[model samples]
Target: MSQLFSPLTLRGIQFNNRIVVSPMCQYASVDGFASDWHLVHLGSRAVGGAGLIIAEAAAISPEGRITPHDLGLWSDEHIPGLKRITNFLKANGSVPGIQLAHAGRKASHNRPWEGGKAIFPNEAEGWQTVAPSALSFAEGGPVPTALDDEGLHKIRYDFREAAERALEAGFRVVEIHAAHGYLLHQFLSPISNQRTDQYGGSFENRVRFLREIIDDVRAIWPTDFPLFVRISATDWTEGGWTPNDSVALSALLKEQGVDLIDCSSGGNVPHATIPVGPGYQVPFAEQIKREAGIPTGAVGLITSAEQAEEIIASGQADLVLLARESLRDPYFPLHAAHTLGDDRPWPVQYERAKPRG
Candidate 1:
């Protein structure tokens, strides 16, 4: 059997194939609730035969949301809608996962469709954003408040509570979104984090926040379920977070019971020159897996069955996550299986549309 279609067992959860639906934000929620849009968006990917479907980054608190419309897990009221989606995903043979996120200084921004500008806390649909350091993501943008000890402690508690809520929502995998210049990544990157405290400066100090979050989440997350950490392997700029940093961090995460690293890049620095191309981020996964001795997921510009198959076949990455391509073709996994001559079952309702054997 093709490795791309092979089963991968992480912790006690068995994935039917290596293809995962990478979390893509659809600014379609209200008050942090998962609406029917989320149900259909995630459910269709499951129906399309992905082994795993990671829901879009769900904020741990209202202030953590990237935009007002981003999904959230901070309230018990959010559970039923998520539970409904998980039920559908599991019934369709896909493991449902969620990327728990805090956007830090990037929070309180207009949605992409709405110009993507920073919104003032006093303005409509906006609130004060917080981060490791009081800095603006770009010139003339709003400056975020540097997190105090009490705020930091609250964020940690929020993560643990979010993990508990995810479990109650029946999610099988819980991925911490430490990548893409978000709250945790802010602490990790020297370019963003400028604190003199225990959570910044030296590598060990910078990684303290993420390490503590892993400890908090794992304390509540079940042992049998997998825990994934999504990280931007590089900032693509000098004096920024690098692939080496990712490898080092992955090593510590592995020791803390993190099952996999979802490797992507270039969200930390707005001006970083990333060589965007096909499978551009795959090398990060390869290096981290080889150097850190941890399983990794390769994402970014991976759009073809052949390309994805080669990645897994070459042992470059243990999993291939598709975002834009999956959006374009929700059934990409089923189509990929057929393209690679790996027989994956199509849903009974769609079997007639399946291509010739």
Candidate 2:
């Protein structure tokens, strides 16, 4: 078998292959609970042949949601549904993972297809949103209330409780979503973080929230299970968070028990012109892996088998994470095994589709 299909044992969790299902929010949850929609949405991918299947950004608290519809792991009641999905994924040979996130100023918004506007706090279902600074994503976006020391502490507790719930839900991997201009990212960027407090200003100060989260999560997270952090390597805007910042942060995360850096870019700002191209973000993963000495997952438009293989073979990244391509072809990994001429077995039920060897 090639490197991509080789067994990867990190800490104690072992992956059958390197294909990880990148977290893509379904925006389909109801009252922060995963429904039947998520079961089939995620479980089908596991059956389709991904080695690691991570659920979408699950809000740590209700107000932390990107939309009213986001899945959450905040309460004990949310565990049963998630446990069902995780059990299914594990039974099918996929390592179950969850992306823990707080959307910050991006919270209380409608879904992208539903105009994507902020829901006013005075409105029926809307409430106050919080961030490191009182900033909004755009003109129509809500002006989020800045977090006080007490509020920050509350969020930390919220995350801690959610981590406990994730453990109860049978998840093996926990990835803290600190990227995409979310609450954690809001604290990390000078463009958004206008606070004079310790949670803002210098790099160490800006990254303090994420650091505290890693500390809190590591306190509860099983050492045998892997912990990952997804970071936007650059904000793709002038004077925003840069790749150097990511390298420094990755180094700190490694010290904080983070096993991998999922390198994805260009979500802190919507206007910044990203030099978009196929596999454009792979270099970010490459840079972080080499500079920070941490295993990184490369994502963004990595659509083909050869593209994914060359990424691993040439060492651009330790793992290739696919979102859109995986959605387009859920069976890509099985087909890739055939196209790449690897002897990896297909699902027994689908053995007839296997290429003659």
* Local distance difference test scores for all models: 0.95, 0.91
Q: Candidate 2 residues 1-357, lDDT tens each? A: 777787788999999999999999999999899999999999888988899998999999999998999999888999999999999999998999999999998899888999888898998778899988888888767788999989999999998899899999999999999899898988898999989988888998999989999999999999899999999999999999999999999999999899999999877786889999999999999999999999999999999998999999999898899999988988888888878888777779888877897
Off by over 4 Å in 2: none
Q: How many residue pairs clash in each candidate?
A: 0, 0
| lDDT tens per residue, model 1, 134-239 | 9899898889999999999999999999999999999999999999999999999999999999988999999999999999999999999999999999999999
Candidate 1: 10-residue stretch with minimal lDDT = 265-274
Q: Which predicted model would earn the best lDDT? A: 1
Residue clash pairs of candidate 1 = none
Candidate whose TM-score is highest: 1
**Predicted candidate 1: what Cα RMSD to the true structure?**
0.7
